[model samples]
Target: MTEKTAETKVTEAQRAALGLAQLSEDERRRGLLSIADAIDEHHEEILEANERDVTAGEELLAAGEYSQALVDRLKLSASKLDSISEMVRSVAHQDDPLEKTLAARRLDEGLDLYKVAVPIGVVGTVFESRPDALVQIAALCLKSGNAVILKGGSEASHSNRVLYELIREATAELPDGWAQLVEAREDVDALLEMDDSIDLLMPRGSSEFVRYIQNNTSIPVLGHTEGICHVYVDEAADLEMASDVAYDAKVQYPAVCNAVETLLVHEDVAEEFLPEIAARYEQAGVELRGDDATREIVEEAEAATEDDWSTEYGDLVLSIKVVDSLEAALDHITTYGSKHTESIVTDDDERASRFMRSLDSASVFHNASTRFSDGYRFGLGAEVGISTGKIHARGPVGLEGLTTYKYHLEGDGHVVASYAGDDVKPYLHEELEAEWTPGDRSDE
Candidate 1:
């Protein structure tokens, strides 16, 4: 622990030879598609390796050191391996994000400002037992024109390593290094020091871990620190639809970031709605923790406290509060909610519109399950993380989330002096009358 083993660095020549993903977009997509084929072809070896990792993870579970749910998530299932292959195809065939010029302006007579898409260069992702993240982060970065270094937890190390091998072998067709896996847990320190090597770092797990990486690195991070999501059943809501959306949001996938952790009902509906919703949660095995007002209506609910309202229990746990008005619901959420994803199960267009505008969350749904806050559901080909933060990216982070734009100037020997000259009057700009369309270059 005192002195580290002699560090090895990628030599300039070695780095050039180790082709990661600096290929043409077509080349990158072909590489990723081949990975999907390889994964399907080598499914048995991957599963056997994953089984061994899960078996060892059982010891960690029996000691009460790790939750059984967490251990379960650590293991890859038959269907999930299939999902990885599907994601690879999904990302491969999607529209090219890099093809579009997001903005274009005539800066001068000849100097034109063309904002073009560029890669984040190199990425590092730190996540827990979710082995699928291996393919996700890799595929996302590759398609978006960047390389990635993935670090999955030790619980799923064997599975992760095997997956990495498939991706590496599949993407080896690239003349440039497109993806790399840092296998050892001890490599984390060197990872942090890789500000020079890595461009952006995204950590997906606990709030503490995300916060630690955020505080430690000066490199920009795009991720959610936590998922204390909420769902507010407004006064004008349709009783049946509201109940269905709320119940599904909380109970469908109770252990994910988008699962509803808190529910707020307006006073107009609280009396009739609380008991109805409580019964549904009971049927779904959800533990309802209610505030005094909610308890008065739903007698069986355990009393909710300030702590319960603020807590993000990624289990069958929910906190309910009764609000006198829509304003109160918004106020409560603005105060305690995690700014992750939230929804208003209201039929009234005005109310839904107002609530959507007022609530400051990444994805604000209207009469829909909060659980639908996902990449595939939103038609995003794949997602690296569900970002709750507001800076670079927010909501379901797909390929579009991982990149930043740089100004590409096409100048015909014109200088900024042309604009700075006293004789020159800057021409007022006008919108083009025709429907604006970016000419397709990716296909060409």
Candidate 2:
């Protein structure tokens, strides 16, 4: 038998997606649970494969070809495996994303229309590093009843191959081609051309890479680009609380997209808050670069260049700026932030509310850490990626994000001619408090 090409694989996934979409919610849930169990049972094998990738990644890191952040994301441990498995189960337990009635209205006496949720058919996702993303994306796609075609970064080829094979074998009872893994770099360009076979293309990577995907693909692209997130300490903020929030936002996990990259301090609190946070960051080995005002307050800080504001370091480096007021802070973020996630710490409810409402980012937090802007933390299970676009899905693209709705209309042998003719009847368009049952009459 001949080996299947990338086009053949995606085409098979497209056909399988139709069957997967018709499955019962419980059936899809079980398939996800199966994947979770398989992960737990074969975690040792996963770690072994991951080790090979990490070893090679470390050699590349020495050569300066790969960043420490990429290697960190590529390597997986037993604890991380546990978290990955648990995330899968969490997705399995989420509310059914399919067949939910979004809106119900009576068009006429017997004609009723319903907006029902359904799968988006075949999804082709290209993500960078983070082998765990494979599990999250696959589980979310299956639970939402959509087939997926995945392409991971070359850095995690070994890890991705193992995880993909494991998930494919675990879900053997389901449609044969529900999940397809394309390992070659060339597969991505091929995927970009299959607009007719794939319904949605989600790419998670650097801004330039995402732009490249968007430009080349005729298929609709859901892009997750660089995250230049921020944290602001308001003049009205409690200095102690602000210190803790700022510290956690940047230091907790600096390699992920939600991690804070810039720190904005109100002038009123800069003298006091900067020293405290700088000390903590220093203790944690964070390299701080600041503007002239920030450098004045923290003399030990290095001068921040203009480009630092828009860069996502994805490391233990932070950029600091001193803003004279909340308005100044907002202006700075609007100008340089990636519209990903931003947090403000303040005691004034009105100010907090204003800040939250004013920012157009995917998530704006008040009195909390910017790192809290995650799908798993938000209780939507794990995210395929954090989307910065204002499109069909924004923020964390989870199970619900993987779905789109279809309009279901039910009528009783009703003819359009009856509503048209000498006396044309008007549409009621009245809202209803009812759920849709398949084949059920609207008037009954």
Candidate 3:
């Protein structure tokens, strides 16, 4: 008789995260090495699985289930594969933020207070078709001493599972169940409800998906809701610089998160700048949605709508609006932006300075493309994701984003009662910037 008993399942999200967060620096380094080892050992398997996903992805796109860009990004090549492995190695080589002592103070003669970095514990990532995100996220979480649980898109499910297998095989040398992935039903709810096992959820797909995760789960969610990035051409903007930056921001990689979705040009330079940028978009086959003012200015542009302003057109679609001044652009972004990346092109020193200081996005740029608002360009070895939420990490979540702090007080049993005494007083303090710059701030 072929009879079977009930099968049980377990989510390592919480357990892995808690374990990774509590790991010593040396253990964390070992985790990073394990990911690198996995990628190196399973290259052929990962490549084969990617090929199958590509075939299925093509059929899905043919049926209008996936986009061309998404499919293409999901295809993994040798160089990209090697890069992911190198990234894990690099992450292991970087400084361990969780080991840093952020602050220290004296409560009494023998007692001291300490603020040190600690992991946020288990991090759950829900991303789209990019298979490399699995490796990158795993590398970052391990090196930062946080465990990660990934839930990729349906189109890449097979590929994701295969990749997870590879990672697990590589890390088999580590403590049992130290590294893990979520392979539950795509029911979305089951994935979201693994909150019982997950400490945090990072959705790196569309605004809708991220919101879904945030709405359903009590777990902390990381990643931007949208990347309606903008590039403002100032009145005194250098035409060449503005054109190049705008083109690169829009056309360089139109399908990714960092690409520009909106173009704001000061009326003073609208005629000159608009024609140049519009022509580039035209050549790239990018659809242009222009405001009435922009429509009056550009003949071939289509009429814009309220929805266009708030949309994250992860394609060759861009929204164009004319602003009276730099202030207008900043205000518009503040109103409609997901607070991702915003750039101002100008030769005016005052306007540039003010724009940089005024905008409230994760990355504010001057005389550059919004594309530069990335992990690698910003010199971070790798990034888990670009986050918009204000609570934990606000911008690109690099090594520093993975860490929260813990106070380690030494000095012969320090007691708060001493500071409460008549003559004793508590220490003064200041809030630290969430910015995770890699180097020391120069005194200059």
Best by TM-score: 2
* Backbone clashes, each candidate: 7, 0, 3
Off by over 4 Å in 1: 1-22, 108-110, 415-444
Alpha-carbon shift of residue 30 in model 2 (angstroms): 1.1
Instruction: Give the lDDT ranking, best first.
Output: 2, 1, 3
**Which candidate gets the maximum lDDT versus the true structure?**
2
TM-score of each: 0.89, 0.98, 0.87
Clashing residue pairs, backbone N/CA/C < 3 A, model 3 = 14-197, 17-122, 118-404
Between candidates 2 and 3, the one scoring higher on lDDT is: 2
Worst 10 residues of 2 by lDDT: 435-444
Per-residue C-alpha lDDT of model 3 across residues 51-95, encoded as one tens digit per residue = 999999899899998888788778888888888888888888888
Clashes of 3: 3
Q: Give me the runs in candidate 3 sitting further than 4 Å from their true place.
A: 1-27, 37-42, 186-188, 191-197, 413-444
lDDT of 2 by residue, 1-444 (tens): 976899999989988998999999889888889999999999899999999999999999999999998888888999999999999999999999999999899888778899999999999999999999999999999999999999998889989999999999989989999999998889999999998999999999999999999999899999999999999999999999999999999999999999999999999988988998999999999999999999988988999999999999999999999998889999999999999999999999999999999999999999999889889999999898899998989998888889999898888787888778889978899998768988866554
What TM-score quantifies how close candidate 2 is to the native fold? 0.98
* Candidate 1 residue-wise lDDT, 1-444, digit = tens: 453221232222125323432456787789889989999998899999999888888987888787765776777777888998998899998887774577766544444555676666777788887788888888887788776767788889899989988887887667444566666767766677656666788889888888878877777777656788888998898988899999998888777788899999998998888888899999988888998888888888899988997888888899999999888988999999888888998879998888999988899989889898888778788899988888788899998887777766555675656566778767433222221133321211
